[model samples]
Target: MSTVAPRFRSHAEDILDALRENPDREALVHGHRRVTAGEFHDLVHRTAWAMQGQGIERGQTVTLLSGNLPEAIAVRYAAHLIGAQVNHLYTGLSADVQAAIVHDVETRALVVDPRLADRAAAIVEAVPVKSVLALGPSATADDLLALAATRTTDPFPGQAGPDDICAIRHTGGTTGHPKGICTTYRQVREQRKAGRAGAIETDAARQLVATTIAHAAGMLADGVLESGGTVVMLDDFDPADVLTTVERERITHLWLLPPLLYQLLDHPAMGHTDTSTLRQVLYGGCQSSPARIADAVRRLGPVLVQGYGQNEGGLISVLTPADHDPDDPERLRTAGRILDGVEVEIRDEDGSALPDGEHGEICVRSAMVMQGYWKQPELTASVLRNGWLRTGDIGFRDAEGYLTVVDRLKDMIVVVGGHVYTTELEDLLNSHPDVRQCAVFGVRDEDGMERVHAAVLLAPGATTDSDELRALVRAERGAMYVPARITFPDELPLTDVGKPDKKELRRRATTPTT
Candidate 1:
């Protein structure tokens, strides 16, 4: 393990240095707006001053609800410099989900765009949102930049330490709730070093951030910045646009999800674009079929690097470029050896370390493991028994020490590259007037992709088709959690303990679709 070094400076320090090192260097690109490192730094400071003027005190929670805009990045950095913890919500989220997150975080103000002003207004009334500020011409609370100019440029609320929580990242839970995972400034710094060190080849040059600025993808944005690399942002996932950006910006390093990779490999326009500049491609999030990985390797070159991690931790196990072999037997199967600065062990139910090639829960002890589940000490204790983060994932290590994840110990379902907690889906499905009893499980589709499937027992005299049931779910829950397949079971199988027999459902799903 690399001695956890003292690279302990707030993100603010990095941003400041970037401006000094290359003021004219392109720092961010969104749509028609291309900002230089120097200009971006000034905007961050001005935005911080503006936030302070709006009565957003240091340590206060400021919620950001916007799409991929340059202002969003500026606001986040400004808040960090002033000691305010940022809570970012995807603008694509449902109103109810947004409401839940805002309430859960107890944010005093929301920094949103004009397009989402209506959504923010509806949420602020029900929640404790004292004020709302829009990024564009929609002046509601205060103009972000104008407010900053009024204050002294003499850097108020100085530098932050590593232990200070930088952002509250939310992840879906098996308990039917989404909890915020606290990521500290120090942890973020270490995670960036780990990410770059794991990379077979990465230098302070050109980088591309194609993933949404919501979770791990967004975290990598900061990593690239800290490494003195220029970041080119994408508003959303589009293969054509991604290729253009890579070619136009001379992007060398990039991260992509499996679905996006599939599109990029299959996109007709990709052949015309100049992607020869790409040196490294970090891909992760969900399972990728061997065929997909092989296709990507053939089309995108051997620059593909796959990783396995959760929102709670950074890169856990990464299959670097060195591990990618066209002829190797284990090429497509392993998540790669345990990363440097991280320790891994497969343990049985009794917490005893299991032998090699034996399936068990994967436990990791590292600088990247989260402190604990926010405010849930009992649950935290269960997962953090000793100094390890007991990841609720079923996997085993081979003789070569390459870890392969088999299944989730918990019943969490990852469908189409996104996590869909079964409990959350069940709760939404059960809320329907027609649903008397329902159980959700993940089943494989014709394409061998995992899709959300549900077993529904309707109420007496209640009638509904698969489409109607799906529509009800869409209304009650987000689209991501809706069941793609509905089975009208006479009765759901039950365990001896009376819980829904999900294991039985999995068995039934494997039977011929007929």
Candidate 2:
């Protein structure tokens, strides 16, 4: 009788194949230890077997809360192998928010590191979590090995289809609490394809993940695994650790947000690190200032790529390496053209198509777009029309078919006679010599009209007066873009995912104006 191999139905299978093909190759580098592909696959299968031995059924949702440890990635894959939906939360989430997501997703099994076991217990109290498998300091290497010994090395029964839900990610909300954006196995698979469409795929490139692996970037890390690449993981951002890892691993591919890239370039040893192996650098959390991009290009060559998308919409547009020319006629203004399998449209209030160079809301439709909000049908209906997902961002498209994101629709500050985009003003301000980062908010002035209020954080040991900064912005943007009042701070608030907490900034801006 011919025994048919189990279908490669899950992403775990993809990892397993890669492991089997290169058992001796280093798959993950964390801390002082590195695990080969064969050894890693053994751990994954054994973990899946152990979970099955514990009566954890397939299709059950499991909440994962841990730092960017190699085991955390393994547990996620083990869940995938057993056909469980992995609910990943940011490790820095508050207890209340954690409980909310646990309850919202109905996650029964909790796989968390011992460092966060207390938080896991808090969540268990709020929701009836069936089982808790702890890893790290509280548990020993022997404990994990013992669990693997108890379960057979053979794979557990698989029970997932490509159409089944694979991952549940909670989107940061503006109104109340965050809502889960459930992604199907199909959607996640397509999003991975969209994220790596034009990029050269090579197993020789060592991927170093410096950002928190909780958001879309986390999924990108998993995509690296799917592509048969080695990953260097980090629990937190430390410039020295990043530089050391890059040099040690001869890292060839790096993906970072603009802020993190800025920190990396400013690191004391940045100039000394051997970065010749870096073949590609991708950044796309938000729009980066032109000056910052130029700095990165100068330091890391012209390999910088920018991708624009959100939790609701997956990869939408990409600024390829070819578009990194700082001296181009457009001068690094556009966000490059839309990627393959993406359709972008600029629509007016009535859903009518806007003319080129005229700003409007951006709407996108593709396989990469998310399914919908997990439970909020009303909200889902509002944002997703037919098959298109409406991104509440305002921007115009140039005649050459490049998209330029201006600002969020709700964040547009309407002044006395015209509308001003906070992001545009912030970008212009960030390009100034002394301004490291800035945010603009709408505050009421005389006559109850909304006026633009600016808050700035300066670079270390940098100095510039408000008058000079104002004059710089006025000269670059115009009088309308100048803030009515400007304030300086040592730093700005950041979200768990490391994006600027603009909501908090607006709250602070609305504070009595004292």
Candidate 3:
């Protein structure tokens, strides 16, 4: 009988094919370093071969701790091609948390950056991984790059199938332990495909990725590589450097969080920066300042795209560049229409679908939704009902097919005589002239009763009193929506993933004074 070809295609192989098409073309840039498609291709294969030599095989987990380096990207693909699941230790998380994650994933190989050698050694001391490979020569770990250099550049078919586990990205660790969101190769591939298609499939574009590559930028980077585009990596985000890079690189694509976007807009360089070459600025992680967004649209051309989704469900919807209309301000508040190949429904507590305008839990169904929370079958069952993943976000759909996510299902504040939606108040606060940034959360008193608490960051030279803020909320939303206790913090806390850190905010509100 003739040999049968596998049904599933690996995303790694997709990059390999793209790399083969133009070996000499510049593929990646980091400061002074320039890597061509040929070099990146060889790096992926060589890393894969080196891992295999260390006995890393299919179904094993490969955890990484590194900055946004080109080799980190190669390591991710190399693990994928070898059928190893990948997980990244986020920079902001505590060592204990990272150790717990490493133990939870049962990581077989720990690929670390030379800079993070101490952190990697700490993890190894606690978790005892089978292999410790450093991106470069280090005191604690063996040099993986040196070993890879000895391997041939011969390409091999990917070891994993479509349904095999490709990644186990953990949640932001808001709730006790961070739950690992396990995604299969098929789920990951389809998610990227849908994202690329919705964003307009392009052949080539220079994209600047300034966020953490272990999370949002990771998927975007894969898409950029597959399209034969150049990715300019930034170790850290400086509004000045980002603006300069855009003007220097003639960057066509740029992705950033809303806060970072606002900083870029307000930066002094923004006035002189040549941002006319920008094609689109993809932003989404949390609620954005509508005023700043409109300002960006006025300053830059009409090229603001907002992606709305969570880890449980990939990208559920996107507010396209066209949706950022200056005239229709109400549309700016919306999360936009559901993406293609994705199904979204506003369901009530009983799991029944609600009609438009009725607020309920936002549920989504698509090939992109995670397979399940890693090894948590019961938890998975509670959310994934009949192929639909229940996103804990509470929102309603308008008649025009736009989704508006209000307060989170868990974040609904139970006040003295009624309930308060945090977003309702935060949105109102964000509209005020003096408010720079704010996060509203509920904290329990000694009687185990919840009261509204707000941590706000006032704009420079702003003297808006807490009384005025409360008065504004009372007038706009209602008395109940006003913050019971308002504290003007130096800065609002944000999670590693860029979302508002309500947990930490709540802790601060409840904790006793020194």
Candidate 4:
């Protein structure tokens, strides 16, 4: 045993301790492979040893490019155990986007999932990285798993301090650079100590992870493991597959974005699939349709949970299972009560508090609030005022203490699926040869869902239609960034300051051409 003592241990060590309680319990399930608690614990230790040998020191960033693989989760724990900051790249992002993030995050070691070897290769070729490793064998990088096999699975003291940063999760789909929220090891322990992760989970209380582990799913998975619960990983979310998996695994907890939940509810399999084992159907990546959510509550029983949060604000509020009242549409529209120990205040542009019924930006103060945006002091100062995280989200709290998020102050548009930054889309659109000028904004549909909209002016001798330009965006930034409505006007509206008149463009987007 190493005698090196650290200021404190991370939640990673706590999870390892929990794994021994029932060593034979099924801890991880990925396709045909089943990992018992003992096996996973061993894998984590081996991985930590491998990374340590490679000089993965505390606070060094380890960026991962993987799907929902069990090994990917193990890598996260391994990195955490070694006290390295982990930055998980979301899979669907363009190669350049991933490279930009990896470069900005100052990654010391890049871990690739064998399945994403090609993608990793592209990033590796683009960026000058220190070391590259893969979860399994691939020509793109060194095999981390194979390296781990040669190492001993010996337990060691955690090399992290309570105040040391542990995770850096990016808030934007930013292609230009990386900006992320920083969370410390102390906050991780505080989150657990505060009982925000819910009651203790049994081995029988299985959680299904169909979403990307780079975001909320990762947090949920960690909580599940800390409580000694089993986790079933899905490489991709097919509505039918999710339904069958829920029934097959006897899953007690499932998490989804509103769009994904809608897809599952609409799927033919949902009607026949046995979902009686489900204790919670947690959903909330964006503002959801109340009517659709009400429909879900009626169909799936009173198990729907909507967690309203931000990367910077942590989980501000939670719409509990008991709060999913189908009879009260008004209640369903609300984002539920502010969570315990979390203080929320509605503030206007001048930073003065707003009345309960008035809408303003929701500011939060709590243990879950991030330390700050990683290395961006100016941006951090803009949001973090006197220990409060100014969530760019615009919402109002009723006299009853229920929040109703009606709009967002940020330029990013939040859909049922994902947030598309208008600036990022505009930047992409302006890069095209056919574009003279372009402006992007969001407009709400009749269903109260935000849709991306753009106005463009073609350069001389150019004749690109909206469809062609949309295809370019869809190809470059993925479907989420594709404009729902693209209008090729003779000239784009401009403000007096010569800036693209996005406000006017937004109005024009909502008002169709005659």
Candidate models: Cα lDDT each: 0.73, 0.78, 0.86, 0.80
Look at candidate 4 and tell me the lDDT of residue 353: 93
lDDT: the better of candidates 2 and 4: 4
TM-score of each: 0.77, 0.92, 0.97, 0.80
What pairs collide in candidate 4?
none
- Per-candidate Cα RMSD to the true structure, in Å, reads 11.1, 3.1, 1.6, 10.8
Task: Give Cα distance to truth, residue 49, candidate 1, Å.
Answer: 2.1
Where model 2 places Cα greater than 4 Å from the true spot, the runs are 1-8, 136-146, 173-175, 200-202, 329-331, 443-449, 510-514
Ranking by TM-score: 3, 2, 4, 1
Residues 223-256, model 1: lDDT tens digits: 6665567777776667888888888988888877
Off by over 4 Å in 3: 1-7, 200-202
Candidate 3 steric clashes: 0
In the predicted model 3, the residue pairs found to clash are none
Residue clash pairs of candidate 2: none
lDDT of 3 at 303: 85
Give the alpha carbon lDDT tens digit for every residue of 201-262 in model 3.
33587889888898888788888889989999988777999999999988988888887887
TM-score of 2: 0.92
Clash counts per candidate, in order, are 2, 0, 0, 0
